[model samples]
Target: MSHDDGYGNDSGRTGDGYSTLGGTRQTRTRLPDGEGGDGYGPRRPPRSSRSLVTVVGVIVLLLAAIAFANLGGGDGDKGGTSGGSGGSKAGAAPTAATGTKPVTGKNGEIAAGFSQDQQGAQSAAANYSVALGSAEMFDKTKRDEILGNVIAPSAVGGFRKTLDQAYSATLFKNLGLNEDGTTPTGFTFISRTTPIGTKVTKSSDEQATVEVWCTGLIGLAGEGSTKPVTDGWFTITMELQWINGDWKAVTHSQKDGPAPVGSDTRASSADEIAGAVNGFGGFTYAR
Candidate 1:
């Protein structure tokens, strides 16, 4: 995701993404009812009923896919994000450290004020990016709460409303969730972003620019989940303005991968990825 030491490009090359392109797992498929043999042929039950079920299934899948894409992306709105459409800005230097004590926060502060230190800025950018990208941000109730807690109150209303609209019944189903947001049978959906490294691009007293390089796991996890977990690397650069004291995202943007060579290991089952997401806890990072 990082614009390499010399490598470049994280510009949003969103190929025909999984959004409208996800393939469906055919459930309860019906063969043409002609030969009503015992085991070797299709039995004629009700042609109309079978057709109706197929149509319903198709409708459900379309709706679910829309919901999934909307919920999974454009959280900050496109206009507000930064970086060119080609790749990671040959942005200034990447921050090389994590966990360095912040130069601004008191020892016990959880949501501390802006830091003058580059390290602190990078940490702030990374954590804020995670919060902005989390799955909880798609659920209306929890999303509102988190926005109220982290973002400027003025943005909360718009963010909540837009996201609520995005995670509609159809969208949820398309994302492989039931209409009510529960996981579909035998599959788990992954949307985890793990930061590989961070860098402070620009830092001022009140506003800062930091970049987070992350590889995300996004796809359905489960036995029948055709969209298995796939990875996308990104460099997220946030323009953070210290608000009401603590840092908050004023704007952000993402691009596709600086994806390197693939690993040799077999991908985990949908259940495993799902279980891991359920079991793992995310960090409230600070430097």
Candidate 2:
């Protein structure tokens, strides 16, 4: 994966990769010699369109897992539950749902008003990571709205300025989008973040810092797309401060992953990936 560090520096790692929120990679999927050319060239053979209904079914199940993963309880606990009917050991991180309810307020489309405790800080950090990693952040207007909502008031201006430059027309073209950040006529642009779990490394009545482990999917999911949907793991550290009854981010940064080995599951087609992204909805996370 390749990424720009938002400061004009570019870097990348080989093997399976995902782009950082503000950075992007340019890649292409090649077709057989006799088949059509890449999206950059001629038209390609049309793929069968998968049913959005089937995609929704798969999405529902995946979201069930996502909900459980975010509800992982206990301070600083990683992965799943410590121990339960799934036979995980006393301190083992197992993926099990304890039925913990999610947070219940919104500042516009983003979750807001997290608690002042460690759990609250963790939840806030996780949700903010999602907002920061979303495809909507590519749009200038939406980017400003997201930063204003999630960042600390004292620091929002700096974030806005830095990100405005980071998400430049050049970056947009690298990601296969128009200069203004709109998807081309027939492609589905995907940029989403799912938190695996969060750990609070430091805490206080007025401030806390949390690290959110995450897996993100990015690229253009559609027939003839140069960039196909790909996944990668990363961790984001957010320094949060308690201000005006909510947890607001003072600063955040991302690094490569504690990624697991790749699985043997078959890769889905472009239509399926597009259908799934369009059919599923994101969540409001909680600890």
Candidate 3:
């Protein structure tokens, strides 16, 4: 797969073959060539007007039903009731929260002091994923601080070197940032990862493997920005160890997603997106 870093003049191609602004590659649709007459030859006979109207009405009803079904769990009171068995309750509590309070301690700006249980592992994985994918990772000092806080002590040295190589000057330039990863005078650089949910694939008293399904927004948002902001889904697998009384990532890797289909919501303008990114504060995710 071509790694487009998600910014730049070459139609969103960074020198590293990845776009700093991530996006789902849109597939083009091709229309069939019609038989004769400039590809517009014989048109099909029109359906009955009444039949067409009925079909349209059914489609509208189906869409409404889908919309309502999606809203079912939004109400706090309706979220986790015991619906009858036989799969009726399945959607009622899909991954109910463990009810543990989020970590309030901070190691510099990163969340710290996660519990050593499965819930703690999931929480640590989710929070670490966000910190690792944030725009601060582009700055060397902040990146070092983040890695030092989140990565296991033994792994930090090697991982820091590897990440330094990954976030190269070329990649920064492609992202429309300076060599030091600072945004230009009139631009806002955004890179954020929000974990949808986390699962412990394997766990033990001392170690855990957690998967964080996440959606990320990345790009340069400004007037005349070549790479418009976009979002993409991905999963991060973290191998965590209970070291020094907390869950720390020993190793982690990312893979392109179990992404949902794109929504039909209209895209926001660059200024609107820039404003939102700057205005909104991220969550301290707990599971």
Candidate 4:
């Protein structure tokens, strides 16, 4: 609503996203005399008119106050809850912290013994995504160990057979690593997955399906390297089952991303990238 400033002019927005005052003519209001005037004679608006103006002013102020409250209170009402379901609107993704502590136990280097809830399934999916995408998985021994730990017992053999074929010598060579999956001396092979977020698509006491959105660093980081460290976005979906008192992946698969556009930031040098990967530690994700 635009305001009239007693000159038949409306004061508010113009169509071009800017504010402007628009008027075609002046408007004059004549009123009865003396006391109710502007402390001068014959210029005062009538008492009834003055009351109506006061009421309108109060109503505008009240409406503005309500609008302001609504704008500020929307998110405050939904934050601090878990399960990726808290925000300004229904079904919105959560952006606030869940306030739940990360899992403390470890099965070797892998996170283990996740809580048997929706959050636990999401956490397990995230950690498994990291483990499966790690450089360790390029090595046959470590790869088998990781599968054993994260995969359900009934699915372990199938996973091992599938991964063995997937991580072939050609893949290692293409990634600038030795056929045996070791870093050719003086180069650091990076295959780390950092989970950006997680969502539980289906959940029950016995089984749950989770999708972990992740950003990954891969390739070799070193001076004069054939394959420089590059990043990619992808999502890994894992079907988890409550097996042997913990959540384990029954089936897991990857798909190419809900990717964001690349930024214009300059790429770091090989040594800087390698140094960063060495210096920084990885985190265990929680819901």
Candidate 5:
């Protein structure tokens, strides 16, 4: 709100934002008249009618200030909605921390106790989640590459054997792909998981539980396809331990949801969703 400051106006400013002033503003202080104290002064005369206008002006200004304050505050209210069914993709990212640090001493403490270096441990965790939740995990050849690259040398044999049987022939065929895991005719199979956030659930010198909350796009998204794109959310918790100067995944598990209700708009064609996903990139999380 603009203020007269009893003379000149404030420059380079207008009503910038709203603030709630119901409790924030102070009532105008009138000059004290001749009273029990300060006895030498004569009685003051009645003030001018302009005082009424000034009082009204101050009230409007205070309300405007309140509105400005609310805008700066992060609230449950947002400008747009996704057809009022789910949150808009354009909604500003809601923050959990008001003034919190991304990393405190927990991760540092765990790393310090480990025989391995800290950089190696964090890098290992980041890359391991990428590999485990990638689209390439659907194909045996890519799966082998991922296991070789991300999993520890000692754990590779068991990891590959377990996952090899887990992603079976029938499962691949059901994913709108060829028996060898190629995209079928008139179909574009999509299986991508993007991490939204990561946290150290529990950390120690030898072991830690890093939980990765993720969102994934699954099913085929293409023309003439029976499998339409579907979105799901899950939190995958990986147990990590220090070995060979690096953190390696000991085991991990997933639990579904925090899912929003489906929307009422016309469902976009598989091609559209596929095109959007292909064009837009997933974010690299900070906290």
Candidate 6:
């Protein structure tokens, strides 16, 4: 079963959490001034027109203040401030990259030419995670291409054999895919992984161990489909080596996640989910 490893069948446990790209917003509501009387007590006198005008003016000023704050007043720019010495706070650690540019090279649609640093290894691991967990990985030709491009030369043969066994015919059947990993005529298969963050546990000049925290959606989306699309959270640890001026995965493994509590938002319909997955393109990740 898929479990929380972001692979296998959907019969196992899956997360119900939804992804929202932005931060939480707060909405303030104003209530009636008096306690409820259930039409049993004398009706309270309405506020004077002048008092109502004052409340409206205050609200307008509050809104203007909020707008000004959003325009780089309180915490800084919407893209966030740089972590450079003059701009950042002392002893404050940054969880994301401040000013690093994304990689511009590709190896048959996979990212390539990562720098020989911790950030480069992290970016490579994150992008590799997306490739490995994508629907393309189910197709043999694309799978082989991805394995060749991302896996270290020394590990390609063994990793290819192991993944072939893992993505077996039985697993394809369980996922509502054909033996060749194609979906039924009316169904769409969805498998996408988005990295939440990455941390380098160990690093040196030529090798590093990085863990990518990710959330994924995988299933068959179609009417009457038993395995409707569902999401899961998992962590992938990659042993990366700096080879030929790029970071490549020597070996990688996955386990269940340190997932957050599920949200109360209702799941979208299968058709809606399918349409969304087809319409949205995945991102190129960098640290």
User: Estimated TM-score per prediction?
Assistant: 0.61, 0.70, 0.69, 0.67, 0.54, 0.68
lDDT, candidate 4, 102-142, per-residue tens: 89999889998787766777788788767766667667798
- Regions of candidate 1 where Cα sits further than 4 Å from its true position: 1-91, 102-116
Which number leads on TM-score? Answer: 2
Q: Candidate 6 lDDT, tens digit per residue, 1-287?
A: 01111121111111221110000001111111120011111221332222222222222121111110000001112233223222332122234874779899999998887776667777888898788767776677887888789866765655454345444554566566787768898888877778888776655556666667888776677877755566656565666666788887664545456878777565677778888899999888886
lDDT, candidate 5, 110-157, per-residue tens: 211222322223334444544454556666777677655544455455
Superposed model 3: Cα runs more than 4 Å off: 1-94
Question: RMSD per prediction, one decimal?
Answer: 14.8, 13.1, 16.9, 27.8, 29.0, 20.2
Model 5: residue 254 alpha-carbon error in angstroms: 1.2
**Using alpha carbons, what is the TM-score of model 3?**
0.69
Predictions in order: lDDT: 0.41, 0.55, 0.52, 0.50, 0.38, 0.52
Q: Candidate 3 residues 131-231, lDDT tens each?
A: 76677866779878887898667666655544454455545665567887688888887777788887766555566666678877766778787544556
Q: How many backbone clashes are present in model 6?
A: 0
Q: What are the runs in model 6 whose C-alpha is more than 4 Å off? A: 1-94
**Could you tell me the lDDT of residue 25 within candidate 2?**
22
- Per-residue lDDT over 172-282 for candidate 2, one digit per residue giving the tens place of the 0 to 100 score: 665667888799989988878888987766554566656778887766877788766666676666667677988877655555578897765667788887888899999
- Error at 139, model 5, angstroms: 1.9
**Local error of candidate 3 at 52, Å?**
43
Q: Judging by lDDT, tell me the better candidate of 1 and 5.
A: 1
Q: Report the C-alpha displacement of residue 27, candidate 1, in angstroms.
A: 34
Query: Residue 42, candidate 3: how far off, in angstroms?
Result: 33
- Please give the lDDT score at residue 274 for candidate 5: 72
